[model samples]
Target: MATSNGFGPRALRYLESARNLVGCAGGAVGLGLHFAGLGGVWWPGVVAGLYGVGALLTPAPKPRPPLPPRPEPRPEPQPLPPEVSAPPAPKPEPVPAPEPAPAPDPELVALAAYLDTVPLPPSAGVDGLLAALRAAGPGPVAERIVRHRLPVAVAGYLRARTWQPWAGPDDPDPAVQLGREVDRLAGELA
Candidate 1:
């Protein structure tokens, strides 16, 4: 048909059927390209373009006399979905920051490091304090024991001995106390 656009029927049909841009299977290729485009991939679009595949062009509408406007229809109200009506999830509580570990006692740490090498009674057996010191390292527990507790224990032992030097069987032996201390320190350190 001779129209203002100047495209003959064959040309118009060709424009509408740009699917055959590459040749056969243009529609299938174009569909694949469309899906790829939706998925943020562009290689399919390139392939489609190379194969001469594209969106089908819509023909221009034929001119006609205008008609009177129709009355507006009211839209039906839809009920909210159960999910939409459900309460929102509660926000997670903020995690508390962990407290920093206290510092080790410098004097006790040095003393512990040296204690293992120091000479002791033959009964002490392989120096538990040294093994414990090595195992536990000069950490906070060791520091606390040596700095705050050990001296007090030692002083109390010495005071008891000074007041009552009877060499009695009931009195705590230094060697025995050393072994016990080793076991206790090892447990504490562990």
Candidate 2:
């Protein structure tokens, strides 16, 4: 029988029970007729046996219904009219030019000149080198040293002045190295 909410497992069970009952009634009627002499015993037995076998072999339950078709996705919405569209692109601001580096210190210039007069090994002593550095003052010269733009020999001479415990007499003399750096710097400057 049809149902308002569609046939369910309970309906299937009831139908299966009814099918079994019909098979049993048919078998009983065939036996009763045979006993009453309406048909031969073998004939009725055969009919009842066929009915019972058919009932046993027949499938009762149905397969589940196929899953519902999936809904198709909607397309993306189109852009709005120009009047309601995004604001006009912003103008790019101008970037300022970088400042030029300051000219080299005048004292450093004069120190290079003085170094030119001094011979190799700096007979004037370490005090003379210190004096030249003092004349150049600390600011610009220190910046050059920090940046490592100074010649390697000059850098080595400056480092030697710090007199770490590791430094020894066997190390190349700072004066000789300084002389080489002076020659290089003077040639470049000239």
Candidate 3:
């Protein structure tokens, strides 16, 4: 028997076999001796019988078949050339510029310029302007200017102008300043 921790490759192969021939042989010899009525051999016979039964109870090792050789890889296919070059894309047409806005009504422009000259108390607010325009007299032009909403800055300037006392003739008139703004806006419309 091989010693523990020192088994050769052959010893390993023997262990892997399904049937333990050495144990079977030992059992057969033991049985023969027992049948021959040999004295003082019963213990060895029993041991051998048990060993053979244990070996028979053990499962067999399965044998693995050798793997087949791998096949050579195939070459990749080359890309085919385009049959013909594609036609060039069409260019987009240029868009026409929008026509200038129509000029503002002359009457509205004149009314805005006229309203710019009107002076009132600071407390008047925009309502005061509207009231003044109404008091000026009932006309299509006055009505239009009264109905039109003044820009915030223009309204604020008008209100501030009301708070200041009448300036010297040398100083610039607030009305004239306001009229200039109106002209500028009217020019833009034109």
Best by TM-score: 1
- lDDT, residue 140, candidate 2: 53
- Predicted candidate 2 versus true structure: per-residue lDDT over 23-51, tens digit per residue: 77667777677778775748667557856
Over 139-175, each residue of candidate 3 has an lDDT whose tens digit, in order, gives 5555445445345436756765776576565766665
Taken over the whole model, the C-alpha lDDT of each candidate is 0.59, 0.59, 0.58
**Model 1 whole-model lDDT (C-alpha atoms):** 0.59
TM-score of 2: 0.22
- Model 1 residue 170 lDDT? 78
Highest-lDDT candidate: 2
- The CA lDDT at 187 in model 3 is 36
Report the lDDT tens digits of candidate 1 across residue range 58-149: 34446688898998998987877987886778999999989866455467566556554655555644355544555565668877766655
By lDDT, highest first, what's the ranking? 2, 1, 3
Cα displacement (angstroms), candidate 1, residue 93, comes to 42
Our tally of clashes for model 1 stands at 1
Worst 10 residues of 1 by lDDT: 52-61
Cα RMSD (angstroms) for every candidate in the order listed: 21.7, 25.5, 28.5
